[model samples]
Target: MADAPPPDATGAGKRRGGTSGKVADFRYKRPAQPEKKRRDARSGHERSGPERSGRERSGQASPLPSQMRPDAGAQSRAGSARRQAYAALDLGTNNCRLLIARPSGENFTVIDAFSRVVRLGEGLAASGRLSDVAMDRALAALHVCAEKLRRRNVHLARSVATEACRRAANGERFIERVREETGIALDIISAQEEARLAVLGCHILLEDGRDGTRGPAVIFDIGGGSTELVLIEPGGPVPRILDWMSVPWGVVSLTDSVDGPDGTAAGRAARYAAMRAIVDKSFAPFARRIAPYRDTDEGIRLLGTSGTVTTLASLHLELPQYDRRAVDGLVVPSASMRDISTRLSTMSEAERGTLPCIGDDRANLVVAGCAILESILDIWPARDLAVADRGIREGILRSLIAADAEGERSREELQRARDVTRSGASL
Candidate 1:
């Protein structure tokens, strides 16, 4: 199926930093202060706010202009030409990623990007706290992120720490230390917000429903410390999130719960079954809640964003090495995924690691991820699975770009109002 249209800027309108799913008018409100201050209600220094500043990205729809004072119009267009670069940083349980880009047309162009698997939540599952080793590894990755932001001269940025930071007992302390050490503020967002952003960033890749298939689509993000599943009703500027749920079971967490080593084939299978049972139980509530949506005439549309799906998709394609271009947006048979999951469960960590995509870093954890994916597939029963290389970071960029455009629109409106007043006074 062909891809859906990229989100239109007008459709996005003025949104705080998170979910803007409402279908009503999207009006841009100019902030009272030039630099809008973010309030930290829980932690004194933890900053949280709607992304308020940045220049708009390219490829977004612009406001239709009426007769304007030529000078003011020219000035506004010229100002837009001086595009400001924006950055979005997502520090998840297993990886730290950064993207720096400037508005291109309706979308943006990536100027610089960075990604590293630091396993920030490595020991959080068993210890219930971030280990010193894990923290140190994460900080090393963040230090690199900070330098990139500095060199890029980012005009606006939003940094977020996900499941690892959200669940670990030392999460807050770690956030504080990150600020003190790297000069980066990390917002530990709720799982609900996390799901929304994942959908926002990747929904464009959803394939249109085929004949005999229509209705709400299932979009999920399988992370290191947790997994987020979202049920969205498609059609419109943005898909409306009808329901969502987050389970504590993720690759790291699930792997931690199971035994240390894969001894025999039977032992590995048992461990895999145990992992599936854990996820299935966690997903039961959400599965029941969304059962009605599944009964619709349309086929179940499922899209997944995470290392698990990407890696599995890569294996399914028989890629000698990992390739983002070939994997992202690729759709595969659900049976194929299930077969791969079952196959991986039987193999030892060493054997799985030898494969092109599942290296040493992911070897121990991939089994847990496969278990979670199978559980999701079991409940949703989508015939095909869609893969997304983009997620929270991409979503953040879209939000920042939309917010910047809203600000510009508001300023234009104000300018037009002032011009009208002057014209009346002259008359």
Candidate 2:
């Protein structure tokens, strides 16, 4: 709730102090929709009434993603009122991903999706600013998202930039450029909000705790520039956040910080050890705080939502290629995960690239991810590691939909009250 930084030369808000935080952008691009609709969505936004677009009548809506299904009444609902579409864009240090969805009953159905590894945080740990090349890559990806938003006529949308933007000196400058270029505002969310969103998005996949005695669950999101670890008390509509911490030691940051030759076994081991030590130190405070949970009757339930865990889960499944249906919601043994991490940590980048899921895009960085994962295991020692492909984007969509629902209910109530007032006046 603090005042945003003052505008600098670039017209983007300038950070006063060297603070480590993030910004997240929320937008609703309605190129095809009416100007009033666009303006309204920008301020308070649309309600998810059954509003059908031309495309829906034409049966041109994009198919839902693998994780979601179309309800039987989806088509009927589309005709009721204005079908308000929502979009969530997550521009992280390592990847640019976008999801566009429409409310379908209690859940939203994804209409379109896009993902590309832009590595916006590349060299950020060393440079303390977003490099031109990285920014260009991210902008290119955002352009695609912008186009999609326009074509989909997204009524409610939010685009968030994580660790990379949060850590860079010119983060706001780049955000301004993004807004000017793509008409998409990028919000660099704080670490705590990032952690909360990640948990909200993926915690549904947590294995039932009622099967046995349940302990507090641990949900961690390993991003490109930073990693977030959140502890929660389960058994509620949504897990209540017990405690959490965000460390600036994700794949890109860790790998850049501890650079060495990993082509050889000895070299890889040495570099991996360095990475672990750094993460261990970064996580020491959180570890000490959660020491009590380690001794619970039922050990910690750990759920991970990030490219790191998904890639590892793919490797565990020995999939021919990355499959979201197979990887998402998977429960892998902790020991097995540790073994995979160790094996991957030792393998040279080239060797790792040759594997099924850890291709060239993830070759060099997977080792750092492994190190972080291992350090997590060392602390929270969970029996099983649950994998989630969903995170911030899903969380954003859910929030937008929930807000829309509330707005819709309020509108209905107001209408009913007006109807009663009119009747009384006529009487």
Candidate 3:
């Protein structure tokens, strides 16, 4: 959870500084790659095997040119120059996403990525078990993700399941089916790990030097099933994680709790407020614990990752369509965010669906997400917010690569030291 390094202000396409001295750069570009083929001709031919348990048997196919391919020779070079690639997958309450990238200098390039809204925990709030319909939807999305991973030729990858799976009694069974059908394994990560990765993934976005004195900035990730909050200190070999917690409520879970499956505007609004109140109440204990970190003199900045912030960024720009480039890492004024949240609150589901940025797929669920974001804002009251499109997946990828590189370096250094010691003993 190391604090992110300060951003390079002179870089092309960076955010502009505001009166509050917060930067609002939104210059993210989707990694350029060839258009992916919809269906693989050999997909049907792949056999299902039980070589592993829980989604590990979803046999993968050969990767396409657009996916990441590492050079083995490069990996044998010096540790810093190693050309190792890493991959991470996040199967949360709503979306199933995967990212595979090869480290390039200080930053990594996205070679291939996949995302789909599965709403796995769609009815888990009331049912206490994953609904058959929700499971089917999640499996379908996971099938596509498996195909993408196979096509991308991912070598080292970690897939994680969050609150939905953690809470459900049938979660293990669901994971088994996924492995049998899709050949992917889902590791249900702990709340602490979730918070750590959320901070790791988004830390790069909070690189303003003005907040150097803050012992640890508060980082929050609002997902479909839960919200993860982490207090992280800057300037370390790694980020120092002070505190972390996972609230049981997220957009999908809260929506299901408040409004039934068929969430309408009135239903959504009422639920939104209720959900907000619940979340506010839950935060009181954690808030009191971290009260000292809120001092402005310490320079605490709020970093948020998830649909809530990304959707807010999209609405702020009034995009004709959902564009990750425009929305990712965009900073929004607290007032502007509140205004957008207010406008969204007043709109019916149908009206919300009409908005280009929020299609029917998100009309109902987005309100829950908005309510969560608004609540966090009210609690933290930061003048500016740094939005991140990257999250658990990115964090996983970075951690894997960083760990691998460090291990390789450590091995080499140990060998060198051993040789020196042997020479001295011989003399």
Best by lDDT: 2
The order by descending lDDT is: 2, 1, 3
User: Could you tell me the C-alpha RMSD of candidate 2 in Å?
Assistant: 9.2
Give the better candidate number (2 or 3) by lDDT: 2
Give the whole-model CA lDDT for all candidates, comma-separated. Answer: 0.73, 0.74, 0.67
Which residue runs does candidate 3 get wrong by more than 4 Å? 1-81, 209-216, 260-269, 414-427
List where candidate 2 sits over 4 angstroms from the true fold: 1-82, 210-213
lDDT tens readout by residue for model 1, 1-427: 1133222212211222232221111111112322222221122222211221121122332111010111232344536622766777888898888777777677777776777777898878778899999998787777666666666666667777778887778898998888766677777776766777788888887746655456678899999888988888878767877777788778988998888654899899899989988899888888888898888666678999999999999999999888787887898999999999999999998999999888887898999999999999988998989898788878877777777667677888999999999999999
Clashes of each: 14, 15, 12
lDDT of 3: 0.67
Question: How well does model 1 score by local distance difference test?
Answer: 0.73
lDDT of 3 by residue, 262-305 (tens): 35657656756787788888666667777777775656677889
Pick the TM-score winner.
2
Please list the residue runs of candidate 1 whose C-alpha ends up more than 4 Å from where it truly belongs after superposition. Answer: 1-78, 210-212, 422-427
Query: Which consecutive 10 residues in model 3 have the weakest lDDT in total?
Result: 17-26
What's the CA RMSD for each of the models? Answer: 10.0, 9.2, 11.5
